[model samples]
Target chain A: MNSTLLRTSALRSALRAAAPKTSSRAGLAGTTFVRSKVTLPDLPYDYGALEPAISGKIMELHHSKHHNTYVTSFNNFSEQMAEAKHKEDIQTQIALQPLINFHGGGHINHSLFWENLAPTSKGGGEPPKGQLAKAINDNYGSLDAFKEKFNAALAGIQGSGWAWLVQDTQTGGIQIKTYANQDPVVGQFRPILGIDAWEHAYYLQYENRKAEYFKAIWDVINWQAAEKRFK
Target chain B: MSAPTYTLPPLPYAYDALEPHISAQIMELHHNKHHQTYITNLNSALRSQAEAVHASDITTQVSLQQAIKFNAGGHINHSLFWQNLAPASSVDAKSSSAPELIKQIKATWGDEESFREAFKAALLGIQGSGWGWLVKVETGKEQRLAIVTTKDQDPIVGKGETPIFGVDMWEHAYYLQYLNGKASYVENIWNVINWKTAEERFKGTRADAFRIFKASI
Candidate 1:
């Protein structure tokens, strides 16, 4: 069979296996094109909560405009893919890769970005506890050692990318990685902490001196959210 | 308006702040020349991409992919890299440390040395373009620290892991000083390791973990 037919069949099978949340069998049918819905995620805190570290304007634009564009594109891609599959079209599916990459990436990156931040008023300053703390000390000699290493790596990325604390799916251990553009973290690693380095992420507040802005962002990190995600 | 000219990010500390481990010359070049290139390229790409999209009347906006990835990644990566560094004098491991952070590391890895050895080994083992990390994992029962490696610009904390420490192994990270022998670079990078920030992260990780556990159960 053609690649389109194969992808369509695979997608159908996968959707079928999803245990359709909706009762209508129409939801499972391969005939009609049904667009998947993608909604804008609400920021957990008020727009100005991360002020000083992250300005309200940046947050407003990053979330409302930048992230919204991703959501819309993602939904469009899903609908188009669904339609292409129904029509037994493989070339179209392949062409949609960039759309999925850009929009899907935007959605995933921003979602993490929002959760990673919290108002400094909250216990955002609270540190790691128990086994997590133990591991940090043991590995780097001291927490300071880890920070130095982490920061050095963070500063090393060539351009617009993200610094992350991730879990290796293979070993179930945490690792740090950086991805450029909207590159998604593939496979087993799960992100626990992330720092956005895109210029827009800091420019207005720190100007060309990106380091100043980076230094400040840590003050508002949502450790509480990170802890929950880690668990 | 003409495109903004990108300059090298000025080092927060003197070239010798890191001293014996990372030389002043190395620091100067790394920050001033290398990082500056990334910024310049990122801005250049964005502008050209914007122009291309406008000229072609291609609403699909596909050509901007490379520009965004290359330039944007460069910008974000370097920004984090700058913040990650600090003077070694600022850290005090035994007494000045955050209690919870020290306690957690001791619980998981026995002692700081053991943890260092493991983390260092992970860093030393990178085969190609990649990084090594020490991170905290929040298990249902407790938060734990584990070490792992990754390829290219892959951020250690993407899908869900909290990154505590990372070691860069890319050629640009060490090539000027260590040349083709990455092992030497890996060994040397450790001299400038920052312990203070790692401690702060530990404090935050522990507190966060406890709160989550209590709330979940």
Candidate 2:
């Protein structure tokens, strides 16, 4: 985990160093610069791997169509922002903020969500172990109790949103949080697990009986991935 | 001044009235739970906005813009939506009941079928949670009809424009029965549209069209 964190920060610093320091009309006239673009991450499992819990059709649409749209839109808006910034167009930049947040957060959330699932054959639904298990037991008495609380939060979400199990970076305690729309878990909270409550997540199979989807998702939850995040 | 509270308005027809087109379960949850939650949240946001106003807190007031817009728009849109629908068996469900509105629709799109096709296309074009509206736009003495869509609980509030009728394109509107078959939901909605209400809204003033919303406060 320490190595991974170190690598991420190192890459970020490298990118920052490569970025242009100043925007000038002469500098922009004919210069070519590298701009990083976010791309849709490949799912860890096949579309059909989750099986009876979630349909392959739904997974295909969710990943290819929905998640890809976010990635594409985020990149598009980022390009627009760069152009706006160069022109000193404050109003245009301000107007693009919400679109950037929505699509960028959607990309971040879905990327994490894909990593947090695995086929049942590949340790999906396996219970948490070691430190993660102890934390769950300490926080909510039992894993069953924790899941019940998580499911309740998932069910209570209005319209399109996600429910997350997050760890406080400061206190190192876990809590369930709900975000409206594509709002991501940020600030002091580190997202350990997230379940999308958007209709597109389960409407193909569960329809309006979202409680069924919420309950059934447990069968395919990649707890090992969650446990890693918990650490 | 105190913030005005809003309440959920009852559906104009029974839950099962839409029948095989839309399920009773969908209607019950959509109306009782989904619509009710919006009103509850709207009232809460209004109260918060009122406190912010009293305290002269511009920052808090700005922060509450989204909550107020989402919840209030939800309340207003759903209020109009309930009145916009009728049981398929009712006389109001027939387009002929709205002769003037039908005439306008025909005039706008060459024929009623063409108009419906355009509306259906607009409904399906929406990528996420939203509403599809057929609105009346009046520019001086010239009145025109147009189809428009609003994203995420935004209401039709343009000056000189009034919603003739709107179809809820949100997933909750048909996902229970239609699931991902959004095209079918859009196709079937025309069957339950209350043309009687459409005619009244077409002929009446904006205040008259929004009277149901006023009654909810």
Candidate 3:
């Protein structure tokens, strides 16, 4: 985690350096900026490791095709945004907002989602311990009750979205929240566990039987990750 | 380079026209919110495209293609969808109202029931946000009926093809009323389908079928 944070900070510094200085037109014209591209993150486990919960084909497509599309599209739009900014083209910049939001949120959401799962051999589905377990029990009575509530929230989503178990930054209370489309959980809420309700996440394996996918996913959830986030 | 802006076409009937099969709440949101957003976005993107064209920025113009396609498709699909529905109690909703289209459907699928089943299957088979369409395809004086689907707000754009009618399979279309029972939504949508519109589209030219856009603009 520390190494990941370091790498992210380094990438940010590189991006800052690459950004054209609007005041220095001659400098910008002479120098070529080597922008740092946002690449797809490697999954912690093999695609098939989740097994009966999520199929290998589904994982492969979800990660490689769907998630990668978001990453690539986001990168493309980011480049366009930079150019638009350099040119001071406000209309073009405004038009790029939705694309940036959708693709950027997709990338962020999927990155968190991948970390929120694991294989059974690695303590996946093992109930949360310590503070996270206590928080769940304190807020929602029991783990079973919390799961039921979470699943209900998932089922209630009207369109492609995500159901997240989030901790309120100020109050420290755990709550269930749903976001439409690729909108990410941000601001006052920190997402501890996020289950994607997007059709692409489970349709290849479960098809229209999304309830089964929702139920089955709990079996492979990496509670340890949730616990870490809670702390 | 100024592009014409689009306005949301009013529903042909009241929001409650479909009743128990589809709720007024669903229709209200689907039309007023969802469909309106598409038109608004489409107009905005077109305006941006106009600016891009004026500035001779090929990259910006190219980047706006998806926004154009998605929003324009949404507008086209919803416009057609509204016209292809009537009150469940109206005479236009009956299968008997569309003799020519029914004859073609029977010829293609052997019976109306078989054709409906195939359409339902196409609707249910859509994995994500998409639409299922019953289209008229013409090939060298030979016209045929085919059921097809397009992913994520894509409208039917094939040459020599006209959408007779389409079903919005996006969860927002039925999730408020059907929840996860999409099969039930698929089964019940027939109650409000306007066969008269289907018949007209089947017998008319593609330009005639798409006359709704002209009226709106």
Candidate 4:
């Protein structure tokens, strides 16, 4: 993991402990805030590790630059949000909400994305076992069927966005979903795994060849990690 | 069963027709790639929504709100936007053409130049993806011009006001040519504003009070 991301994780834990009862996001009414600046989380693996699947250059830019901008912008928005809340500026708070969503979504989606993948050597393509496997089979017929449906959702996204395997909040049933831009399906559904269908994710290596990139991602998917989350 | 799909509204002029102000490349990509995607997604959302209604899955239907709104707004905004623009060569600035519209704008903002500035201000002041609209609204038994901005892909049609004209503030509209300079793109856009079409829209909206998006659709 990037050391900054590690620090961010540590800070998040500390913040959770520190402000367990209060809120500061979007300039909502809240108590004093313990400053929490978002930081770029390091990619868990080397850039070249996803090689034949995703080029090192793409990975580097995605993580270092793209994700980094989100982190920095998120932090800035957070600071501004805090100031607005501090001053009880309702109009300013309303204005800042979109920026918060955009940057916050980028931060969250990218952070989850880094954890969502692993190199081939580390059981990336390994299928789920036990309860997770049973659940997949029950809901989607089979793992292959799940992939087929999920990739269809991925391929159909209108613009920059992600296709996700999200557990429905109501029934805990897994469903394939897509969200445009940096939107993360975290509020009503529990996102188990996400595949970025953003052009930047594949434009470099695949160059508008989305279908090929969708197929290639299976080689680097950290199934073991995702299954652990599902269970 | 026949499906209701939103078709991309044909540009008022040729793809390269806007020229110098809005490059053919920008218009082509904006129409074909961006606007086309919105139409496709809107169709898919409406279809799935119909299925959810059939299945009695209210939760799933509710879950699709963002998709429905965003894509529907995209389709509505773009369709109106294409009609609101024309080639610079096509415009005849004869004040006699839209005397009433010009008089109303002048009354509202003191002059056309100030109205343009106010519109630009509303647009430049926007924080993220959205649209800037010049609308004819009845504030209190008086028809007046109001500058409104809607965030992301939210349409202006349902604002209880008739839209005179609107500019797509989405980055996809001008990012290639304008890059980060949205003000520049918006500034040049005025050169192609179809006063004649806007006059017709104004008259049509005045003809029927309930002529917004949902009502017309």
Candidate 5:
């Protein structure tokens, strides 16, 4: 959010908070709300950073065009949801869920997705070092085994989706899961890693050879990036 | 003995049956490869999920819903899909002139041409990978042909609607043959529709509804 939008949002929140508590008006009936405008986060590396595994063209389009659209749509939906909630419009709020899930996932999944890759020169694809390494060993037997399972999960998504390694919050264990069409990790799973399986993610470069795409993506997996989240 | 896993259902016709409209290559890949992958993963998820539940592994059980739903919906949807199509013989014998079915379709859509336009428009309107369906569903007291779509592999049954027929709109369904032009895929698929199967399904559901109504009376 820009500084101007920040000030406006703060002012709106203040005005709502100052409204009479005894009022029966729809908007004033609700407590003060501070809704943040979601903006697309910049990639940590150049578009061409993860060369050979992913192309600069795919990165640029995926980030600027695809991810940006998600951010823009999420913001729009967020604004609508805020308005609906303020008026206590249950039906409208319910209707906004599908849009929220899709665009919100696009924003969150892509945000996590970009950081999960790094240039090979920046130690991308290097083996894990700390707790994540031990966890991978304990849960999946070995890093190679984890990669094999993850690749199979990726290749096996029936349509557009994502493959993830997530922490089972209840058990404090890791498991592999697939999410349909931009759905981020739901349920009790906290995602530790994710790869976009949408055709847009790899279709241009790999065509229909998704096995090749999965194979190459591992070559660019940022263990260091993953480790920080795992810890 | 072990519990039976869902096996891939074979296509009713040869890979070449839907030719020129949806090529053999697309059919083969869609069925043999894509459909099979869903079942395989579903089976895997089912096994682990069963064990997780048996052992009270709540987290694993919860996390497995996506796998179970996506792959099972893939199976259910595709199984209906194969039976939904046939060799290009025009609307099939049963529904071509099925008065009641045609009446409902016309009532809901104004006319046959209007229904086609509306159905195709709904299918084309899907934002991403999903399916477009023509389903017979009750709203208040009347059953009507409600054209709807679902994202990814969510089947119509999940939405409390009995699908009369469905068209796969996933890019994998036609990208090999139609490329980016889904309009052509939607238009051509009509030629191969197995309306006989759809009519049978429609009649069966209506009969059941009638039976319940008569029982109540």
Candidate 6:
């Protein structure tokens, strides 16, 4: 084959090869988090794009309304906190319970929640490549097994919480964990994959049936984006 | 940036999505009630503690220390757990060759799997109400993964190393189905492992590990 043709073939092959791994990544490398004044992020895609799996109504209420409330409250809480600090009023500060965690956690988790999704047509089905694949295979014997285990683990959550696939930094292997609420994996491990088990994440579309929502969200998972998340 | 604030996070999936494995009934209670409780408690503690810290009031700070640790740790760990499990994708494909991060782990413990296995054992072995962590100690940018355990709600950040991964061993974390079967819970949690995020963390913290691994290599 001519060099140009050969190059074209190679390029096609590379693209085909890479198509799979680019789905799940949030592109945090390019996602510059400068910690500017904290504000609610506008949803990147229309709230309804995840339809059937997630309703537009839910997205609207969850994002424009719920998440925004958190952002606003977090800012207000912080401002008051600063004042509390100035006055050295320990009792008043103690009274501010719940506001900081609820709003603060709302802001953080929703930011991640928005980035975790993409439209179904955008390479959301099935994971493409890497140790994530091999690890899944090794641990569960197959991708299907991995998903089953994950879904099962997620289903097993009790009360308001989350299910996660986190890397054990000391051993550098992936491990699954669940947190009661707005807990970040930072202190114990580096977060890699997190599934929100909150009712609000699914109540509208799935009603009180979380499993249906879990099954449906797979349609728009953005696995290729996840691949890029690898270092 | 502005100290810190707390809030409830919306779910990434709809309520019924995880059915069979998880009931929508459970999810409703879990998010609105359980998770919300933590956020509320954390905020209260932070507010009170901020006041004490500003006042330089030893008695108040000391008394609230427990509250701060538990609530703050809960906030920190849960948020990280959310980001860790994105939808499954090949973009997080396993490296065919030794990823630089794996090389460092190998150098430290003879092989990557060995290090991983040891870390797993440490996490799975936790006796009760606490956490297992892998952290990188900073020695002028050189870092190494060290397994540490925290009791109740103490966070690992204050322990002098950059956190890499944290495993929760609380029964509330897995008791619905695993029910006292912590081993099964730990083992099962590995299936949807997110190597991609781990890779980002590895590369981002390379300087910390390089300083330590170079000598051993």
| Candidate 6 residue-wise lDDT, B55-94, digit = tens | 8888998998776667766766554443333333334424
- The estimated TM-scores of all candidates read 0.47, 0.65, 0.55, 0.65, 0.64, 0.43
Point out where model 1 deviates above 4 Å: A1-35, B1-217
The sequence of per-residue lDDT tens digits that candidate 5 reaches over residues A134-209 is: 9999988999999999999987776788999888889888889998887767567877889988877775576667
* Ten contiguous residues minimizing lDDT sum, candidate 4 chain A: A14-23
Worst 10 residues of 3 chain A by lDDT: A14-23
User: Which candidate, 2 or 4, would have the higher DockQ against the true structure?
Assistant: 2
lDDT of 3 by residue, A69-95 (tens): 777888899899879988999999999
TM-score-sorted candidate list, best first:
4, 2, 5, 3, 1, 6
- Tens-digit lDDT string for candidate 2 (A6-28): 54454334323222342332444
User: Which residue ranges in model 4 land beyond 4 Å of their true spot?
Assistant: A1-36, A42-69, A85-99, A117-134, A151-162, A167-174, A177-190, A196-220, B1-9, B19-21, B29-76, B88-130, B139-141, B149-156, B169-192, B203-217
Q: 3 or 6: which has the higher TM-score?
A: 3
**RMSD of each candidate?**
24.9, 8.1, 16.6, 6.8, 9.3, 25.6
- Sorted on DockQ, best first, the list reads 2, 5, 4, 3, 1, 6
lDDT of 1 by residue, A1-231 (tens): 265355434433433322233326565565464554756766767789888778897787777876777678777887787778888899999988776776676677777778778788865545666665666677677656766677766776654577887767677677678877566565677777888776556654554566677677778877666766564
The prediction achieving the highest lDDT against the true structure is: 3
Question: How many residue pairs clash in each candidate at the backbone level?
Answer: 74, 0, 0, 1, 0, 100
In candidate 5, stretches whose alpha carbon ends up further than 4 angstroms from where it belongs are A1-37, A41-51, A54-65, A138-141, A152-160, A167-181, A185-190, A203-212, B1-25, B36-76, B82-100, B111-130, B137-143, B148-162, B174-217
Best by DockQ, which number? 2
Q: Each model's interface RMSD (Å)? A: 11.8, 3.8, 9.5, 5.1, 3.6, 11.9
DockQ of each: 0.03, 0.20, 0.07, 0.09, 0.20, 0.02
How good is chain A of candidate 2, measured by TM-score? Answer: 0.85
Q: Candidate 1 vs candidate 3: which has greater DockQ?
A: 3
After superposition, the stretches of candidate 2 with alpha carbons farther than 4 Å from their true spots are: A1-115, A119-195, A202-231
What fraction of the true interface does each of the listed models get right, in terms of native contacts kept?
0.03, 0.17, 0.08, 0.00, 0.25, 0.00
Q: Report the candidate with higher lDDT, 3 versus 4.
A: 3
